[model samples]
Target: MIVIEGLRKAYGSTPVVDGVSLRIPASGITSIIGPNGAGKSTLLSIMARLMEADGGTVIVDELDVTRTKTDLLARRLSILRQENHISSRLTVRDLVGFGRYPHSKGRLTPEDAGHIDRAIDYLHLGDLADRFLDELSGGQRQRAHIAMVLCQDTDYVLLDEPLNNLDMRHARGMMQLLRRAADELGKTIVLVMHDINFASWYSDGIVAMKAGRVVHHGAPDAIIRPEVLSAIYDMPIAVQDVAGKRIALYYE
Candidate 1:
């Protein structure tokens, strides 16, 4: 389990994540949904140690995230940021191979190569494996980044907007991939997303935030309610059971 306590972060004077605490499950997909500037990305960054928190603690299982060694933590958790603008002109395969750095440390063993190949094939990037990142479309580049994150093969994977720029078809495929990663690989997948419907359909839990505070956290059935969503988003959001799943209808 990922345990958070009194976590806080601020950009100079204005605080983004304010004393928020949460417990994320160990082996399922948990989607963090909130409005823009609701501290979703900041909180994820703090949890992954990508950014320093002003106060409080985060513990993944028994290991303290702040105190753990970088390499040690890298082996247990991997994160993909929402905005990754690395201008190195690296190919898809090269970027995915970087994920094995924690274990291989610049030397690619046969085992690491196997992992690289598996991640490429898992994302259906085998055909474009040799394409440069700049050579692909935005959605394809996003998938390449995801492939790199998945190639890490860590127990915990935190993704900030994994579906960004993806078309409907690609978005569905990405969600299914995340589900497979959780059910088949037993990886703890936590994603920060703007799509409530996708969160309801794929994740085991939904964590809603607003104005630097956690408003609600529960199974999709509980969090997808009209009142709950209306309160979190400050607007009317009607939710209904469609087929066998809860679907939100917020668009007029």
Candidate 2:
């Protein structure tokens, strides 16, 4: 489990994450949803130790994120940030192979090779395995990055906007794959998502943020209501049940 308390970050004086506290349990999909500038990405960055927080602490299980050894933390927790740009031209296979660096230390054993292969196959990247990242489509490149993260095989996975470049078909596939990773592999997955209906349908818990604060956190059924959606987003959002799943509609 991940426990956060009084987590705060500011750009000079403008507070982006204001005293936000959240607890993400183990072995489930937790989706953080909010509007632009709500600090959703900032919060994820802090938890993943990609950025330093101005105040407070993030504890994943027994390890304090700020104090843990870098390699140790990387072995336990893996993160996929929103902006993934590789300056060097590399093939999909080479990128995914990097994920085993923690264990292989630049040497790939049979086990490390196995992990890389599984991740590529899991993301359905076999046909494009030898293709250079620059040669692939945005969605395909995104999958390659995700496959790299999965190849790390960490117990905890944190992704910021995993669906960014994915098409409708690939977006749904990514969510289902993550859900399977959580349920079957017992990996705790936390993602920052922009689509509320997807969060409502796939997430075990939803964290709603606004103005740099967590305004609501609960199960799908509890957080996917019309009143709750309106309050969190500051727009009229209608929700209805379809096939026992709550779907949100905010289209004009």
Over the stretch 1-252, how does candidate 1's per-residue lDDT look in tens digits? Answer: 999999989899999999899999899999999999999999999999999999999999899999999899999999999899986899999999999999889799999999999999988899999999999999999999999998888999999999999999989999999999899989999999999999999999999999899989999999999999999888999999998889999998
TM-score of 1: 0.98
Which of the numbered candidates is closest to the native, going by highest lDDT? 2
Provide the lowest-lDDT 10-residue window in model 1: 82-91
Angstrom error of the Cα, residue 166, model 2: value is 0.7
lDDT of 2 by residue, 1-252 (tens): 999999999999999999999999999999999899999999999998999999999999899999999899999999999888889999999999999998788899999999999999999999999999999999999999999999999999999999999999999999999999999999999999999888988999999999899999999999999999898889999999999999999997
Give residue 235's lDDT in candidate 2 (0 to 100): 93
What are the models' TM-scores? 0.98, 0.99
Identify the runs in model 1 with alpha carbons over 4 angstroms from their true place: none
What clash pairs does model 1 have? none
Question: For residue 145, what is the lDDT in candidate 1?
Answer: 91
